[model samples]
Target: MAQLERFAETRTPASRVDDVVARMRALGDDWPPRDGVAVFNRVYLSVTEEVARRIHLGAFPDAHAAITLDVRFAERYLRAVDAAADGHRPPACWRPLFQYRRHPGVRPLQFALAGINAHIGHDLALALVDSCRTLGCEPADLEDEFDRVGDVLVSLEERIREELMPGPDLLQIGDPLTHLAGAWSLERARDGAWASARTLWALRDLPGVAQEFGERLDGAVGLVGRILLTPLPD
Candidate 1:
């Protein structure tokens, strides 16, 4: 339960953004199977920034394509998980970090997972940009486009929050724990010791609106600290 440091005192938005982009690029070309969340978080932020910048510069086609690609990659993960639920094994194309074998109906879960992560990534990026705006940076050159993206994310967050596990009226809707119980049972039956060891790590830790954000915010912020804000070279 440690608090994240406030980003309030960061350097000007433009400088901080350059720093973020540089640090992300410096992460190099290797991708870890276990780093799906980490990698996507960085890529989404970079894409969002690019879209914002391009739209500002009046590069409409470029901005449109960038956003399209971001949604495509993220949504594809959802599709793969869906396919896996229909008796198909996960596709080899997806990173191992996302491949689920023991669980059924995991496709929707994948969507929930990726959607939440992307939401957090965008949230942090916007916070940085908003901070920049407060610092008197020129009118983002495309404030309307930026706001359009923000509005889509806001709608998506609400939709995902209501559909994914232990929804708002959990008391009436029943616990996701009960539904995913099959997943737990499968894991235990396959390997109880290992499953027992890892179950607690999967529990959701917050409630209501904050819970929705909390679902992926920690992982996103962790990346910002670990990869995006690492000390830059002189």
Candidate 2:
């Protein structure tokens, strides 16, 4: 416990993200490559690495603020990883994906999409608030950086679909994956995250209101995650 806490304390945002990328890479190398979670981990690892490299090159106007936002964003996922490791419950939005992580019937695309749903749907809004608090600014101030990060995620979604999508022989016009993918939109999630972040910032002074809003968001996202993780017939 002491060691973990100490390790957490010592890591700056960049180092923490680097560690996450490394851990994800190791998971990809060590775990079954076709395992759904492993597949998403690999996809997410690519996004993280890209984000970290951009951060190094001063891609953003405000590096500190960007780092704060990125770190807070990454920390939510890391916390889920830690909680699951320790046998503790993670956020509801994340529970479905974790529960279905190794379900053989769940496709790799489902896993990737489910994880994205959990992270963007629940964590992104809260992370904006975290960055706001840490940087002592409003959510609006972080919009540019948020959009940049979101663009990276959006591209990852494309890569994931192209790479993990079932072959034409296995896919049909009415396939469950097709229907599911058609319904879930990263653009919508990104827009919603922005709205939620603004709302959270507005409710920041009222902890009770903020908590309620966040809980509702969590529950809604969890429902979506559940649907995304639905095991399809092989």
Candidate 3:
């Protein structure tokens, strides 16, 4: 409890990103090469570092809001990490990546996609609302920034699919990875997240119902992540 509070106290928005980056790098260095979470961490860390660079360059219209959204978003994942480290269970959205980290059948592409699916699908929407509360504004006010951060994810998603995709020479149409890659789309996830942020904001007064809805969303995204991370045969 004391440790968590101190971490909470000392962590600025910039430092939070740094902490996550450093932690992800450490995990990658220490964990096995094929560990699912580590694989996803490497991809996410790169994107994060890019965002931090953009933030430094004053790339966004409202830098403060952008940094807040980015940090709060990263903190959700970090808290999950801290919880898991403390022997408390992480949120359902994060369970698959952690549970399947060592599964040999899951490829790095699947790992990366599953992590994106979990983070953007579940965490992004909530992070938007969180930033709204902290910034004292409506969801609409952050639309541009949301789309901006999302643009990065969308671009990264395309490159990841292109780079990690099995070659046409080696890939059969029946390949599960081929099918899985086509099945999930980051655009759809972004659309869904926008809708969720709107709905969650509307229901903010009804905390109980909002909490239930968030939990259900987390579970549904987790199920999809688990499917994406399913081990396949060579």
For model 3, how does the per-residue alpha-carbon lDDT over 184-204 read when each residue is reduced to its tens digit?
A: 999999999999999999999
Q: What lDDT is reached at residue 82 by model 3?
A: 72
The local distance difference test score of model 2 is 0.82
TM-score of 2: 0.91
Q: Residue 185 CA error for candidate 2 (Å)?
A: 0.7
For candidate 3, give the lDDT of residue 175: 89
Q: Estimate each model's TM-score.
A: 0.30, 0.91, 0.91
Error of 3 at 154 (Å): 0.9
Model 1 regions lying over 4 Å from their true place = 1-12, 28-34, 55-146, 151-234
lDDT of 1 by residue, 1-234 (tens): 001113213444334334444434443243342344343434345455664465557655435333332332333333443454466653333323244212243333333344233333333233323333344332244344434544444444444434533444443324443233222221112132122112222332323644444434435433322222122121
Lowest summed lDDT across 10 adjacent residues in model 2 is found at 1-10
Write model 2 residue lDDT over 1-234, tens digit each, in one string: 223335655777667666666666766787787776677778778888888888899897877777777777877886887687789999999888878888988998899888888889889999999988878888888989999899889877877887788886756668988778768998899899899999989988899998999999999999998998888897
Better of 1 and 3 by TM-score: 3
